[model samples]
Target: MSVTGAGAASSTPASGAGRRVVILRHAETVDNAARVWQGHKDTELSETGRQQVAAAAPHLAAYRPALLVSSDLQRAAATADAIASLTGLEVRLDARLREVHVGEWQGMHADEVRERYPETIAALDRGEDVPRGLTGETRAEVAHRVGECVREVERELLPGETAVIVAHGVSGRIGATELVGLDQDVSDVIFRGIDNCHWIELVESSKSFSARSRWRISGWNLGPWRL
Candidate 1:
């Protein structure tokens, strides 16, 4: 999951009846540009990142997201703000939507991680859970909290309304897959990873009895082509 823009997978939205949720990853950060691990470390967006989100605004506005929620982290908040500005909605911040906390690896270069923590890198490359970093989190833990966050956000949505959840790349996959009830065993094959400022849309009929059973990927890796 720490491998940003490193893998590939195919996903198609499934049909079910609740709210359509769009999970938007924050614009590129300094770490993202440099392929460094950010984990929960708060990093600001790069200048190019700002421009990328600006380009994404109009397209995101097309969804007319009813409510905007974001990780309080500055990078995500800033991206959410851009989309909110276009949609004319207020942003609600949720810390649970934050990235996986990779303690000591927060600011290390990706190459360094591969060089020093070969096993850790190898595990992630294999799509296996590795909580080997100093106080780092497992993919399941991240998915658990992210799933809870979406459930709470969905509770506040009205029929046919979309809720945009702005978060980091790792959390985007974990949350999106979790929202669609993607099996953990097959998760690696289902989603490789998401790009910065890109989004995955999960839709469900408002009439669905359970959020877990209703959600499916309606759109994946969507964003302004320029971004």
Candidate 2:
């Protein structure tokens, strides 16, 4: 496995060995720039988004990610491609890494969704599972799948190895919270959210054959501007 900036931020004491997992949100997309809901939409990166990657990849290179994994969606894959080139690693694709599926709301603008689906928007804000257009996965569903993805990767990791996961916003947040052992409500408040191309580093360190219950969330929102 590759190594670099995969450190989990946790308050729990360390005992056994643990690995780091970096969860990165894909770069900006045309839909993102337009404030459109891109759930499961195969959107490409915007011009600005490509520039974001060009500027951000070098900073990420410093982390020297050992294994690069990404959502099968083009936007996320494109961003992962930049890192793969920099780190000389191949990108592993997983559909479970894709963003939350918003069903009928794909391509709709934020204002349009807020106006037409006020209850739906409110439900999301409260961390409730309200379908965004008569059909969509609930918050619990998103958390379950993404959490599984994180655990699967974590289980595969040997000591000092790090994996970089490139995905979308909501799913990324869910993954981080789940990995950190935070409940849904608490995670919603703590993670808040991530911007395009930003990333969260969750490190799981263990010592003396004892795994700590708490993981850490360091390096939050590491992005083009911040990096």
Candidate 3:
């Protein structure tokens, strides 16, 4: 079944024997500020992004994350570093958590992309799951790799522990959708791009044994209120 930030029916918080996973979108990057497509383009966080990290770091650290992982890209790595600074955990770099590759569209402004590929843009807005930039990975491709990374995290985390993964906007949602086994159609329609420095939390149900129904999205687009 598909789950939405606003549509999930019920989410059983992890019990004493279950685990929690938090997939965090990295802070804003220069590309983000400029409304550019940054698929696989390594960019540093903007000054505002650094401030966002300062506001958001304490909350993620409070989770006392048992494992910290992130995309190798500088933007995600930088955000992960902040949380690691407080938690004393090593940041495990995972390429699979990187954003959907936009192919030829990397570094292009959103306006340019919209003008050049109106049909593609329209298709995406309709949740068609097509390649983003004529050569970019399709949503399914992104989900496959993202699913691999998330499942690995599931194995690494023990009951009563929380794991934090620093991820990109699109990939983060794909990972969350994979973890919760939400209906893809529902996710495509309902799960929009998450805001910078925000996060989604997934908890494994202690009562469920099936992979398809074991996890739930307990929170979505949650972030710091200060700054």
Candidate 4:
């Protein structure tokens, strides 16, 4: 089933009033390179990551977003900081944009999880909800939270303004799928793997909004260097 909302539309930026929301995944991190589950585990960008952001700055500068927002997580926040510095826009920290907490899987390499908790790992791979960490959030939960966050951005930001959101791959994918009215299962499969520092643009109109893949290389599975 396709999800519909005030923020769903075609690829082109809409006319009339309403703010355009651009979602960007953060640059490369050491955790990303190691193929570890880094949910809610704070990790700084590697030296190469910093350079990647530097290279991407020019492309982001083209948008001239009025406000730049990011998850409070270090990886995303640091990326927002760099973009803000380049664009002269202040960074807004939104905890709601943080990555989905992977519970017991946090900070563990994929191989380790597969070896140690084979059943749980297999369940996750199959999209079956098993008991995760005591406080960890599920994919469904994260989707709801991210949906609300997108609504809040539209409600609070001024019409005709553009806002840039720096977030994690999974969360960003969820948000994108929701915005585009795609089926959850399809979106889940398509977004299961995303690259670092990739970006998607969503343009808003008076009645609705639409999205398009802007730079997949940075956000799909490749690094910023490759872009």
Better of 1 and 4 by TM-score: 1
Candidate 2 displacement at residue 153 in angstroms: 0.9
- Kindly give the stretch of ten consecutive residues in candidate 3 with the minimal lDDT sum: 1-10
**Stretches of model 3 off by over 4 angstroms after superposition:** 1-15
Residue-level lDDT of model 2, residues 1-227, one tens digit each, is 21223322223223344567889899999999999998999999999899988877776666666678899999999999998998899999999988888987888998988898887788777777676566978778888998898888887866667788998898998888888778888767755578788888877644324343547765677654742
Q: How do all the candidates rank in terms of TM-score, highest first?
A: 3, 2, 1, 4
Error of 2 at 135 (Å): 0.3
Q: What is the lDDT of residue 182 in candidate 4?
A: 64
Q: List the residue pairs that clash in candidate 4.
A: 8-209, 9-209, 9-210, 195-219, 195-220, 195-221, 198-218, 198-219
Q: Which number leads on lDDT?
A: 3
Best by TM-score: 3
Residue pairs clashing in model 1 are 13-217, 17-205, 17-208, 18-204, 18-205, 18-206
In order of appearance, the predictions have TM-scores of 0.87, 0.87, 0.91, 0.79
* Candidate 4 residue spans exceeding 4 A from truth: 1-19, 129-135, 205-227
lDDT of 4: 0.70
Q: Give stretches of model 1 more than 4 Å off.
A: 1-18, 205-211
Superposing every Cα of model 3 onto the true structure, what RMSD results?
Answer: 4.1
Candidate number with the higher TM-score (2 or 3) = 3
Task: Please give, for residues 38-114, the per-residue lDDT of candidate 4 as tens digits.
Answer: 88999999877788788776566566677788899999999999888877888889888899898888888888878
